[model samples]
Target: MATAYVDYFPLYIQTGIEAGLLDPELATFDLARLAAAIKPERDLDFAFLGLQTLYDRYLLHIDKTRFELPQAFFLRVAMGISLKEENREERALEFYELLSSFRFMSSTPTLFNSGTTRPQLSSCFLTTVDDDLSGIFAGIRNNALLAKYSGGLGNDWTPVRGIGAKIRGTNGESQGVVPFLKIANDTAVAVNQGGKRKGAVCAYLETWHMDIEEFLDLRKNTGDERRRTHDMNTANWVPDLFLQRVEAGGDWTLFSPDEVPDLHDLYGAAFATAYESYERAADRGEIRVFRRVKAVDLWRRMLTVLFETGHPWITFKDACNLRSPQQHDGVVHSSNLCTEITLNTTVDETAVCNLGSVNLVAHLTGTGLTAAGLDGELLRDTVKTAVRMLDNVIDVNFYTTPESERANQRHRPVGLGLMGFADALFALRIPYSSDAAVAFADSSMEQISYHAIEASSDLAAERGRYQTYDGSLWSQGILPIDSLELLRQARNGDLTVDTGKELDWDVLRVKVLRDGMRNSNVLAIAPTATISNICGVSQSIEPIYRNLFVKSNMSGEFTVANPYLVADLKARGLWDAVMVSDLKYHDGILSQIDRVPADLRELYATAFEMDPMWLIKAASRRQKWLDQAQSLNLYMSAPSGKALDELYRSAWRYGLKTTYYLRSQSATHVEKSTLQGTDGRLNAVPVAAAPVAATPTPAPVASPITTSAVPATPPAPAPEVPMDDSLLDAPAVCLIDDPDCEACQ
Candidate 1:
């Protein structure tokens, strides 16, 4: 550490230069002065996982050795983002301060390739396929190119027509969207970037599409091998009319795009009208390849597939398109891999979004219920900087396809999301199910929404507004919160949609109308399961998974104890090694422990402990402020058909644009957590069936990440590599920053 920073100051640059890891322009900076700006002490704030994540994947490496320390890595990223600024050094310093302080971090792509030769900085891409062989193949090729760069992708499969549809070229019936989706799913698996992680592409099919039934079955375990797409994620793009039909228990009909192509171009009233017209055509035998079923039956099948296989996520088509600020430009045919992005995709343009998340815990002024709270000024400052960094990504990002580049430049969309909501709530000592939690969610997101718009508008003042700013909802002075009225009007009093706003929307609305906005869309909430682990916080807008249970991911299993829970317990003289043992035995749920206080138990409720309604209520609140969407996972202990049905209906009624995964809990026994038995060996504790929410399998590790800012201990030794290429092969490395769910934060 001394040799890299203090002794030579600019040694990292020299080392990087020799290894050919440093960008040529990056080499021209007065790196010695920049090296001097590194705050080595700030490294101590990071828990071991945060530091380990940097060392293993983020730090620039030569061969197998990592020379970049935490502070220097932060500075390098800052320098990369600010390299084009007129006052590069000053701006870099500002970026460094924010990053080194643990206040904010860019998405994975930015961290990986920001200062490298190929800076493909955007996190994910969304594309739409036209109903043609050339266009479909082109969409698949674009998916490969983008996935070859970064993993997350969203493809709209609705326009590709359906089974028994006429084919002009072959004079045979079309095979429908499933066969094409299979190719896309296989492409994602085949084109993973340098084998870093399996590329993930979410194929979205509308509920109205005739192929929707098979699309829902793509993830089923018992499905025909040729039909199942186990590798790729799937989502149902349901419009409001379908939900209304389901609500009224009316008959629902599905049609192929080949026959009812106009339905693909409509939404809300226009969509309902076009859909009925298509149904009438089908009745008259004008439209072929159509199927009719009870709306509730189809809705039930959608839920059954979702709960059974956890794919084909439920996303509201009308809600997404209706709420989209860029609805003027095109329709939002699909959401991105994580179900957070809602950008428009057309035949000529593939929607793109650059993503970054604010570490919510870092923005809080202090820790614990009494000390920690959000300072309005500080949050605004952090969001302003984060928005700027995300916007900068647009210019710096390397696009893989012309369509992606075209869409990105025109709409200039960015997903400014957040992590550590659970952590922030823990600090405030709020129960996940409490009304207070909902209020906090509502207020915090409102603040983020306000400042993000303000920052975007401010950027537009300096730079010009996005190319498609005209005729957008923003041009009409309609903010996301105000757009609910549009939905109410579009639905014609069939639904009562409320903004549930605690903040003054009118004031923010006026500011937005006056200043114009730079970006088309903002404020999406990602799972942040990976990035949160790097920052040592809970996943985005999610309740704590466990207090002392092992979190197993690619890096291996980590025995994470909730620090805030510990602090609260310790304050009441309840926390100790015994308490830890008990928590481990009970699988980190406090309610099972008799000695724990009732209030603390409520505050420490895990995902399955609270009602799914609370999740919906809070998300609905957050959704009101967000212009995009959130990757919301709803948990159910012993999920039932009736329970699942009501939950989704409530979600639609609350106006949530998307729900990522329906994580059902299983009745399983808790295992002993590294506790010694009579033989002084770890024993599995045989206990009553404890409910466990389903999550991606956790891979526990034996080693712990060191947290000292200073080198109180030497850097951990690196694993050895074989000299012969064929002698030894390393296991495929998966990104550990997030849970299996896109590992985002």
Candidate 2:
């Protein structure tokens, strides 16, 4: 394969250029040097899942030949992103080293089309819907075009008027945002995102919207089919005032956007004052259409719907806006599809963000994670190069809509996140549920945040500041750490975020204020669902889902075992056929394995085994350093309204800008099959013969998943069962399939 890649790469490029699949401006001699620079041996780095994913969706092919090898694929993406650099060859080589070495990777979109004929390298697009008929239809049209090029969509539907509102032009009542959302939902299903993936879109309605009740039912199976947007994701654009009202048991009023138009734009104390005045107007019979309900009732309903159908994910409007670096430019109506991106959207400009992630596992040195294990200098270099590559994506991209192009040029926002966080934790031997893990989350994010900001500032000195640099948070010398204060003030110090710092942020702040910033926002932690597979790492900051399980995806099922766990068990001479049987019997949990050491078991606890608060605590630490937000997914073994309420409220109190999903274990279990050997005694299956696992089983057998941070005592283990092929069919944990759209990878 390596020899074929080296010999046929030129022919592949030539054929691609002739077939209109590649850029025709290439010089043959330069391509020759790049092709030779490819180190085919690095292909060995790919795990089965990662390599299969690349082969299935990413590698450039002609007539299914798949002539482009792994090294060539990396070089192609590197060359594509660095086309505009002064020394293009040198820059491409730098990017190639970063990517091919598995130290950094561009998002899936960039990897898919970076050096192609039309490079649509952006991941997420945010658009604000207008109230008029033409504008609504136009927004739908924009969704089709953007999805055609594989961009995930986030539409702000807050501006559309609710049902029962007067429509003066037609002399009729407005049918509400739900009908239009139904149309948008169908559009996303129809597009299919360039035939590579499904068209993913999320509709965001403010908590104050009168249609909030109907919006919450969009994902329910028993809902009126026409009113339900079963294909679309929904989230509540919650303001701090609403949560405060819920806490105080105050009355919450819902109004149509047409009547309370300013509420869509106002946030923080301004929004609170305006909302109260509107309520007073309603009480005096001044406002046209308004409904009042107990705030606690509405809050409970929100949590109930979330637990039932998983729609309308809880997101904080005030926290997103208050912490936005582009606050001076515009309002952040909603987050992008995966809930990581928080950018400003307007009528003329659709927000665009190019994304990439650093491989946290790649930067670790030494056996145990001491201060000396982190290679800060190497990380700094990676950040600088990754930022430059992201910046170039804006200039070289093929925009699907005029609004997206406008936004990309003006703000030039980019998300630089990290993958392999869980893998890093495993390598360092840290338990995910421990305070040590939380501290690591804080410290690691602080370093990443510091370097990302400094890199953007350095870029500004070289490439000039972004067009909207002035009057922004960077111009005011307030970085992400400083922005937490703004959220604190907005919540009147009710916020519970730990404002800790480890880096010399003071020096970076001065440098940013002086040199400006190349992008409006940097450092958003996207889901990294697909890209992490390509890098053979854990997804962005997620805890280990299982120690062993089968992963099901488009390509088929593949068994994935934790290498770290296997190695540890092997070192202790406990990793034999019986141990494998024990693992499968317990459904990939180590806490119940008596033979495993307590420390190793603690280090390898699955996501559902730990209390959900551990996830929140670590996420809160990372959130403080992030400019935008992280795609936080909260897990609960048995979800209840109260548990859901406490978990989401803690997220808000901790100042999380947005959350992605509410994952819970189902009530059913995968039927256990019996395995017997020649002697009619039960025997363990070997790794080679492990069968595929079932999907969506109950949370592993143990104490039910908790919502509190206080650790609970481990549940007693069950008596040993006879091992058989049945054990091999254990439930696959974590993300077995692509949960989020690959656009944000």
Candidate 3:
């Protein structure tokens, strides 16, 4: 493997440059030295799914044959990102080590275009659509161009007037935001992200809009075909006032932006005041094209629509704006496609964010939690370098639109997050639903937050602060933790999130104030759908979906087994054909297996098997450290309206800025025909047994196991049934088909 890479690297570089795929400057590198640094053995680290994904879409290929192997691919990306550095070769090597060793990984776009001629390294972009026709078309056109270069998008549509609003120039009623959204959806479909991936865009509408009900129905299959935006993602830009009204069971009024234009920019108390005043105007018959409805009724409808069709994700407007570090600069109208990026978007300035993640599994010091389990020094060094690489992307990136270029240059935001949280937990022997897990979430994020802030401050000391740094929260010496006070004040002391700190944040605060900050925003947690696969780790901040399942993707199907569970079983002499059959019989759920140890069952409990409130609690801990937001997905095996109400309310009370997909247990079961030697046979499962409901509280850990046993002989082969291809097509734990899922990495 080593010899193959060493000999072919120079030739690959030559072919790439000749084909105009690679940067011309790459030809000047010491090809021999770079090739010699390639550690082909790291290729062994890849699971089948990871390697297949790389080969299918990531690796640089010529004539449909991959010329760049895994290590070479990492080196190529590192070299592309480090091309402008003073010691470009050294920096490239350092970055290569991080990538190949699975210590850090950049977003999909950065990996795709990093070493290429057009390095469109930014992952996500946000643009606010103006109410006017020209401005709306401009925003749509910008979407096409941005998506053409493989960037995910979020468009704030609150400024556009709702249906029944008067159009003064034409002296007619407007058809509403839905029709324009239809055109935007078509544009995204047409672009298709340069044919590499689906062109994805999310449309956000404020809850107070008169067309709010119609916006909520965009993804429903029952709606009029012409009125629905089936191709585009939708999110409700919910204000705290709406929730307050819902809780109060009071009436809520809607308005057209033309009549209430400033509502798009207002948030928190100002929004509440203006909204209430508008309600009174509607009651007094002073406002036109306004409607009134019970807030509770509307809230129930929102949840019902959400359960029926997974659209119009619930995202809080006030939590996003109130806790924003750039609150002094502008208001955050909405989050990006993944709901992880909360930034100010305007007609003149489109928001752009560069993203990357550190592999948490690489920073651990032992297999189980110790007093000093996480290597603080190693994480600090990794974050420092990762931040530098992300910062370099802004200078070297190929911007498709001038608006994106403008916003990126002025604020220079970078999201340095993490992956492999579940894997790290497994290594630490901590159950996902336990208090120890929540505590680790807090400490780990606190450490990442501390280092990311300090890293930006270090960059500011050397390279000067961002152009708009003076008016930001850093200028006021308020970090993400300290900014919670702003949210508390905005919510009138109703907020209920923990603000405990383990690190000496004041020292970092003093450093930030003294040196200013290189980036306006430093942290966000994107759903690392594909990159986590490349690293062979669990998805970003997600619980284990299953112990064993076949994952399907663009690369094809591959079996994913929990290696940690397998190792523990093998140690206890429980690994056998019977165990595989048992897993298949229960659809990879270990809790039902009588032969498996109770402690192991708790440790390996799948996502749906555990109470989802634990996910919320863990996210709340992480949210306090994240400056932007997190792409948090809640999983429920059995869902109810009441449970959803309590869960989302907990999210808001915990000060969560945004939420992502709400995954429910699929009715389909994995086929058991693929087991070795068993043919079509499956281990006997109790016919009357039913799945346990995931209660909203943590359950105590099971007692440790002393002994376990498996049957001496496997069950005989049984009659085969016709195969269902749908089972093969079902999404794996990590790779949901949502277009925005992996776009932000």
Candidate 4:
């Protein structure tokens, strides 16, 4: 790391200059001052995972000799974003201070290629493909271009004709979206991001599409090789009418968009009426190539596919559009790769979101956290600066396609999210599943929403409202909380929400209504999987995966223990060799340990130990205020069809925009990470900073994970096992499948 100053820095600059990657002015910076500003001590802040994430993909490499250190990487991104400021040098220092100190972090692309030859600083790009063959191929080309850089792709396939539909140009029947999706999947694999990570894209199809059934099978292990798209992500763009049909036990009719074009553009009651009309028309033989099925049966199949193959994610189409501030610009066709992004995409315009996350761990008070709760003013300041950094990305970004650039400049949307929520909650000593945790979730997210809006309003004052802000929901002062009524209407009063406003919304609405807002949409809670690892905390809005486990990533497997749990244990003199053995033998949960306090056990329950509704309930509160969606994942120790039905129904009843994956305990995939082997068992190693023990963390049993299909594929009939209290004592880690699109996090 020290060589960044004496050796690696000048060589990198020389290489950058030779490749025309660095700004000409960068070569003239005072090296002496830069070296002085660099604090190598901050490097110690990185846990093994954070340092490895930086080393493998982020650190600048010359002939595979790692050079750019962590602090320097922050400064480089700061410099790149500040290039056009009047006092750019000083502004760079300011940005560097915010970043190096871990108060803020830009998205992966911004950190990776920021000051490089081809700087692509945006995280997500949403585009709609035209229904024609030329347009479809063009969309494929666009995906390649964007994925070649760093943008995760979301393509809306709703407009395309379904299987057996007549094609006017070719005088043949359409093969439907599945064949094209395979190509897109291959495109994602073929266009890896400089071999650092896989290029990720998600194809979205509306539930009414005739190809929807086949689309769900894209990720199955035993599918026709031509149909399986294991490399790409798939999501269902479901409308509220379908859920109502499932509830009412009505038949759902699938139609080709070619036969029923208007349904794709409609939502709410308009959609229901148009869809019923299409069903009647198909019954009268006015429409061709239609299939009818029991809505509940189809719903079961969707859940089956999701549970079996880990996708097609269930994302509500109407709720996303109904709640969208940018609904007037165009309908929200689909969410982005990780499912947190909700933006409009059309053939003429591509939606783009430049993302940054505030590290919530830094939001503690000056009076020490216990004395005073969360510091609201500091959170506002952090969010304001983060918004500025994200806005700067719109100008600094290298748009791969003209459509993306056009839409980005017009709407100027930015996603300002948060990470380390679990860490913050742990610091506050709130149990993961408690009512207090739910209340805290509501308050903290309300604070983020409160300040993020004010900060965006501040930007509007300085930079003027976004080009399309005049007729947006913000222009009418329709905040996200107010838009819940629209969703209630869409779901026909089935949705339940706590009708409470904690903040002074009346005053803020007036301010926003009078001044307008800068961004079209804000506040997306991404998976934050990789970045949370980089920050050495729990992933976005997630509980601890395990109190101790081995984390596998681009870096080699490293022993990871929840440092908060360790500190609490060490404080009570409960951390010892036997405690380590017990933790390893029982897979890092404290329920089986008799010596620990009951409250401590309750507070430190692993992801699988607590009921999942707690996670959803908490997310529902955040979703109430978030303009964009969240990458919410549902976990179950024992899953059954009935259980899935109730769980998803509750998710809709609570009005969540999207859910990522349905993780099951017995079916955990071990491809990415495992903690079972004797060589890899995590002992008392801290999650972040703690005094090292005289002896290293002990690796328990040496048994490796079973590499077989049994673990990967659960039985067809979802297990109906009751929640067993005894299973909490079992020696199994709560392994989560990392998103294929870890680059965005």
Task: Give the top-scoring candidate (lDDT).
Answer: 3
After superposing candidate 2 on the true structure, give the runs of residues whose Cα lies further than 4 Å from its correct spot.
Answer: 1-4, 367-372, 667-738
User: All candidates' lDDT scores?
Assistant: 0.75, 0.81, 0.83, 0.77
**Which residues of candidate 4, in runs, are more than 4 Å off?**
1-15, 19-21, 28-35, 366-372, 666-735
TM-score of 2: 0.92
Give the alpha carbon lDDT tens digit for every residue of 462-508 in model 4: 88989999888898889988988888876667776665667899988
Error of 2 at 514 (Å): 1.6
lDDT of 2 by residue, 1-745 (tens): 6567768778877877887788875543387777778888888888778889999888878787776778878988888888888888888899999999888999988998988988999999999999999999999999999988889999999999999999999899998999999999999999987778889999999999999999988987775798998888899999999988877768999999899889999999999999999999999999999999988778877777776676688998999999999999999999999899999999899999999999887887553322123578888899989999999999999998999999999999999999888877776656788776787788788888899999999999998999999999899999999999998887778777888787888899899988999999999998888888888788888887777766665666665667777766766677677777777677678888899987778778887888788888889899999989998887777555555666778888878888877766642221234424422112323443332211111111221112233256322121221222221222223233554456688
lDDT of 3: 0.83
lDDT for position 324 in model 1: 85
Candidate 1 structure quality by residue, lDDT tens digits, 371-461: 3457789889999988988888888778888988898998899989888888777766666776667777887888898889999999888
Per-residue lDDT of 287 in model 2? 93
Ten contiguous residues with the weakest lDDT in model 4: 698-707
**Superposition TM-score, candidate 3 onto the true structure:** 0.92
Among residues 3 or more apart in sequence or in different chains, the pairs in candidate 3 whose N, CA or C atoms overlap within 3 Å are: 367-427
Candidate 3 positional error at 635, Å: 0.8
Clash totals for all candidate models: 14, 1, 1, 2
Predictions: Cα RMSD each: 10.7, 7.0, 8.2, 7.0
Cα lDDT for residue 68, candidate 3: 75
